[model samples]
Target chain A: MLKIMIIGATSVIAQETARFFATEGAEFFLVGIPADKLVVIKDDLVARGAKRAEVYEADLTDFDKHPQIIESAVQAMGSIDAVLIAHGTLGNQKAAEASVEVALKEINLNLLSNISLLTLLGNYFEKQRRGCIAVISSVAGDRGRGSNYVYGTAKAGTTTFMQGLRSRLAKSGVAVVTIKPGLVDTPMTADIKKNFLFSDPATVGKAIYLGMKKGKDTVYAPWFWRYIMAIIIHIPEFIFKKMSL
Target chain B: MTTPLNRLKQYKSWGRYPTVEHKAIHQIHWRSDLPDVNQFEETVLPYGYGRSYGDSCLNEGGILLDTSYMQQFIAFDAEQGLVRCEAGVSLEQILEVIVPCGWFLPVTPGTKFVSIGGAIANDVHGKNHHRAGTFGCHVTQFELVRSDGTYICSPTENAELFRATIGGLGLTGIITWAEFKLKRIPSPLIDQEKIRFANLDEFFAISAEMDQRFEYLMSWSDCLSGGDSMGRGIFMAGNFYDPPLGAEPSAKKLKPFVPFDLPSIALNTLSVKAFNAVLYRVPLGKRVRSIVHYEPFYYPLDAINNWYRLYGKRGFLQYQLVVPLEGDNEPIREVYRRIAQSGEGSFLVVLKAFGDIASPGMLSFPMPGVTLALDFAFNGEKTLKLLDELDTIVREARGRVYPAKDARMSPENFRAYYPQWEAFAHYIDPKFSSSFWRRVTASAKSANGQ
Candidate 1:
């Protein structure tokens, strides 16, 4: 049975991605905020055929707690054979635009906290010598847009960090997969008006599960997002800045 | 908390009919975050996937508390074929988890995309209704969150509310999660057979015989067939194939999708007639047999996602009505005759017999009846007129139209069909209401001068 650690067990995308692992009779060390929601996910993973799903309730934004959280999860699961960091807020772009404090807070939760967990897990996995490390970055990181630049900045930082982690651990036999998903319908994006560009969480989740299992280096969920993001990324800065995306 | 994304959104029932008035959506992602039902200034109703064909799952001028993200599996017992899952979990998702463990849904509707909560609220029946009854019959327990508080409902706990909630059309409250039993299956593949019947009499005769041995039975009828050929169509029967069956149960594959609406001229009467003729001649009463995957056996149309787009911009209506089995099937034969006369019937038609097993839901639609369901492209007044005539015949025959598939049944007809609405109304959550609830209840109340 696989032993895995999921950082954001409560989020819809995280739960959906975790389900693939669960059905394979994986054992889980789940960490997320809100104890009740975490417990619900734990029960859910077990129901989906997981051998065990242990919950470690923690506010992932609390950076000081990162070491303890990682240690506790690894201890609880015996030892993690794979790790997925799937927690982050969309972080209201308008609110962040209104205040520097909001922007920093958004970055702290989405970028800095993840970096802390990565550093801790990085050391543990590097010593263990074999494992898959996956993180959910977003296509928004390809190029910042006015509508959600705050979130874009955080995702961009995350993508860059995973890139460095991948190269640094290349010889250590540690695999790093960076997942950039576009427009997934989850509670995080519940407020967004959905269109053809959007896909259900299950679709994106299955992609993540497959990418992690295959140890793909960099991936885009739902495939189409790659072409969409490529077009967006190639748009000239002069014309792009004039148009609201 | 409203954002650019939370602007008032126009939602469509799967059938895309009656044009729902716009409503703001408040998403409920976690049980801990469930909104206070009484707190919304606009009335509230839970919306899950909008898979219901008509307005039963919609709300006009109210907040749609969307529960699609509330999907999660709570418990599973492969040994006993028991599962408890969040209400928003789709049958498709459940199949992914349980099919490997050798369990299957006790009952399933045509589409696997429907949420468990929607299935329960509609009390959807399936081909296996002859043996398994409606989906609600297997729901062992669920959590209903109302304006008052959360209540755990089952047959023995809050029993009346449980009955009302089943087939309650989101009026009772939000079903946060539910527990139900699953039937054991040897494998996910179906050993299916097809035979063409000459007419309605032969169809019924063969159906009854197949019901004795098969776990699933259904028929596809030519909607425009009449007189001697009336109800002549293909009868299909199947059971889950036992043993590994020499082939691994293949994974659910990506379905081809209709990316955009087909033009209105694409499915006219002549075209539908030609298609029906081709289908009718292919089977030829040969009793062809094959071992097929359950995906195709139960949901052939699902092979193409958004296949209803073929009906074009105006959308379509799925007029499904069940005529009781107590009398001669003259009324059913009459329904086919009327549709054939209208020249508006589409190629797709389904006929099935519900057995004597009674559904526990007070508002449940099945009652020892043969249900006829056909699709009609909305031709404005002409199609509406035809359906209205069918309703009169059905009402006189003590038949009932399925609310889940109805967009335009009159309030009087609805009350006539489901007289237990008064008992069910008593259990409706004070804070929960829907477009359909308002259409039937409010109009009926005003008509009575109450």
Candidate 2:
């Protein structure tokens, strides 16, 4: 069975993804915070027909623990086929502005943690000579706008870091995939406008699975998100910064 | 999956589509070409003139079998106005050779850089869509290299394949050659007429009336127009120029300007809105007729090369959605109203009327409806919100957005647009896929799994 490790598996996006992998007859190693929530997700994965479902409770902000945590997860899974760095905290922009600690935490959680995890996995996969690593970046990474520049800055760094990683790992047997999601309708953004074109978590989950299977380096979840981002990114920055969006 | 890596690094460069980056490059020899009947069974994307606006041209990290090297004219029957050529031959190339012989493409897209194969692959339609439909309609026969690499002459012999290959987006096979019914033209010029419409209703009235008299019709709408005048636009109608009213013939001089890249600040709401206002007010409430060259009439934007760069390094997204004409124009009007109210300034908005000509592709993005295309810059959160709202309107209207132009539609919305999506899935080669394809199909597969 294909052994898949999904970081932040308790996320609505990850739950849907776990269900997809379960249906595909694969084993899963789900990692998330709060042990109880992980257990609930684990049971759901098991009930959905995953060959084996295991969970690890760890804080992504603690960079030092990522190597050991990923190593342990890989050991339990026995030769990791794919690793999805999907855990992220969409921290409050206003809160981040008020405290440097909050801003740094956002950065560490969104970019630094993923970087450390990716470096560990990249090394592991290169050594194994066969594996895939998929990172869930956001379309916000395409360009920085005033509305969400704090979050956009973090994602931008992650996306750029992933691009560099992809170039480095292209010749190696390891494949790195970056997913740029526009808007996803999940617990994360439940209060957002209903008319907002947020993709269903299930849809995003499927895209992640297919992207790994196809070995696509970068995927814009909900294909149209690519175009939407394209137009926004193309806007003149001078004028864009003034807009209230 | 092992072959000698012929590293033609430069060939793997950029394409019309920004998302797709070249992966592997292969060179095919035209002298010793094999007409195998099953060469297309493998993951093969039919490459033509490389004029596709997106990833349809080159499959990054995949094989791009360049067909442009195989340019050869097979035959031309002047009496019947039938022209046949290798798929690699472009419309520009054909026009250069045959326009003096009083013939032109029956249906031409905005650009002449497209190949006959690419044209048929996309089932491209021009301003004359209401009258002539798409280029696929004029095609008489084509040779499809099927999945298994067998060459099948698809006209009447393999009729299903013929229809499938027409708008199949090059998924079925590579087109080696094709025969199209060309139209006879008096000269390489067009008799053009420009008219201004005060609002959406007036624009529709003028377009409907002109459709019966003119061979081609198109409209440029001021998307910035708000409130009651949301879809106000300018209508342009044209017909073949008749020898330019007894004037002495002179050699045509083509002006070319290559814009390497524009400063990110070149295109803005202020400038675009200004351009749109001037365009709308220029022909103020009057119809002006003039004789114009074919270049300006067909490809007005061709004057600026790498024009996409004008949107700046960040690039622009093209949103083209089609709403069915159910006798009530409310659906379209409401969409425009939302766009205007949203204050997401989109300057390049084109409105057109699509007739009953059907596309053979299971997931093609055209039907009997009014299609509107707009360009917007990615402005972060606000743009996302605008697109989301647009998607809702399109979904409620039971309309679909063009996949080629789209970069952010959900899988559920995609399914709603293409009900025959399952059939498309069956045709996908296991070894063939792209970032765009993977994102779409991966979501589709998961949706089905659920």
Candidate 3:
């Protein structure tokens, strides 16, 4: 059984991804906010056939608590075979644009918090000589737009950081996976307008699970989003600015 | 409420009739932050995949709590065949998780797309009703979140609320989570047999014998066969059968799909009658006995994805009525006679007998009798008049129409059919309501002027 540590275990996507592994009788160390929700996830994973499920509640944005969280997860699981960072939010775009404080807070929660956990897990996996690291980035990071550049910038940073970490970790036989999903219908994106393009959380969860298992460097949730993003990235800046995407 | 495309036509029931606009809709993802009915203007109803055939799934000028995303299995016991899951989890999802574990739903409706909450709220029955009873029969317990407070309900605890909420149609409260027993299956395949019956008498005779031998029994009646030849149909019987040693469940083959709505003229009287006539004869050539997958045997219409589109843009209403065997069976014949005279025969008509197994729910549909269900394509006032006529026949015979399949049953008829509705209304949450509830109880509300 794989010993996996998942931050943001309360996320619908994260819970589904964890469930995919649970069927295989994997062990888990879950860390997320709201201790009560985390307890539900722990029970769910155990019921789904997980060998063991231990939870730690902590606000991931607190940089000071990063070390303590990582240390506790390691002590709980004994050894980590894989790690998935699957928590973030789409904060109010209008608020972020009007205030620099709002923009930085979202950036810190979405980008800095993940980078801090990766920093600790990266070192641990590197010295251990074998493991996998996965993070749920988004296609919004592929290019910036007026609608949500603040959230985009944060995801873009994490996506680039994973790229750099993959090269460094490869020498020690560690694998790093960066998952980039398009619009997903979840509580996080509940307020956003959705269409045929918005995939359900369950489908995206299975994709994330498969991408992590294959240890892919960059993966798209619906697979078609890969080609869709490829076409969008080629649009000229002058024409793109005029189009109200 | 989310997409521009979906915003154009808010939401619809399975029948796609009496389309109503809701003031707002909230998508629930987790059980913790469930939407409170008091927060929204007008009435509120929990909507799950919109499987109710008529107005029961709708709440016009009100709010809808769409709980399709609140799907998560809370607990599972493969050995004990007991599983618990969030309310929005569909029967299809449960089947996927448990079928591999050699277990199956104790009772499943025609389609696997219906959510667990919707199943209990409607008290849906299956082909095995003669054996296993309604879906609510196996439910051990569930958490009901009402405006007043949350209540843990079961047969032994909060028993009154439990009975009321089973077929209460989402007015009692929003079910957060539910736990039920699963049927232990030796294999996923079923030993099925089909025999032709010439008339209603033959069909009933065959059913009586089949009920004693098979766990699943159902029939397909040709609605066009009127006069002395009326009710000619095929009887089907099935029992769980083990597969050959070392056989594995095969990957699902691609199914036929109805991608878009067909023109309203596609199912005209002549074409529908011809199709039904052809369908009856085709089965005669096939082998009488075969080992088949349970999914196909239980849900043949689901073979085509979105088969509802076949009814066309105008939509169709499923007319389902049941009467006890203690009364004269002539009411059903008169009902079918009216449909034939109207020249609005549907392509598919089903008949089945409900056994003596009593349901725990107060307003559950089935009893010690048989039910007949058929789809009537919406054709303005003419179709409505025909339905009203049939309702009178069924009402006078001491039978009742199914609320889930009804769009326009008269308030007086509903009052007479379920005399317990007056007492049952007391348990309804003050802030929860549905279009069907309001339509059926209009007289009651106005007479009391409360």
lDDT by residue (A80-149, candidate 1, tens digit) is: 8998998989988889989999999999988998899899888988999999999999999999999999
lDDT of 2 by residue, A80-184 (tens): 998888888787888888899998888988888888888888888888878889989999889877677788898999999989888888878788999988787
lDDT of 1 by residue, B1-450 (tens): 001121232467878887777467778778668988777777888887777888887888888888766777888898998899888788888888888888999999988878889999999989999999999999999999999989999999999989999999999999999999999887777777888888898887777788998889988888787888888888888988875546554545312221211223344434887877777877545697777778777876655656667777798998999988754688988888888898986777889888989888999998888888888888999999999999988898898999999988888888888989998999988888888888876556434422
Per-model DockQ: 0.43, 0.01, 0.36
How does the DockQ of candidate 3 come out? 0.36
Each candidate: what lDDT? 0.84, 0.71, 0.84
Task: List the pairs of residues colliding in candidate 1.
Answer: A191-B5
- Better candidate number, 1 or 2, judged by lDDT: 1
Cα lDDT for residue B188, candidate 1: 77
* Candidates ranked by DockQ: 1, 3, 2
- Candidate 1 has a TM-score of 0.92
What C-alpha lDDT, on a 0 to 100 scale, does residue A10 get in candidate 2?
67
Ranking of all predicted structures according to lDDT, beginning with the best and ending with the worst: 3, 1, 2
Per-model root-mean-square deviation over C-alphas: 4.2, 22.4, 3.8
Q: Write the residue-wise lDDT of candidate 2 on B1-450 in tens digits.
A: 001111122332122235555544333323125334244343445565545554555566666666654444556665677777667667776675557667888989777766677788777788887877788888888876654554554567667667666766676666777888989888776777888788888877776788887888888898877766767777878898776476724326421221111123444435767877877776645787776677777876655555666666655666888888866678788878877787877767888888777755455677878889887776667776887788878878888887656666667777777777677767554444444455555546446423
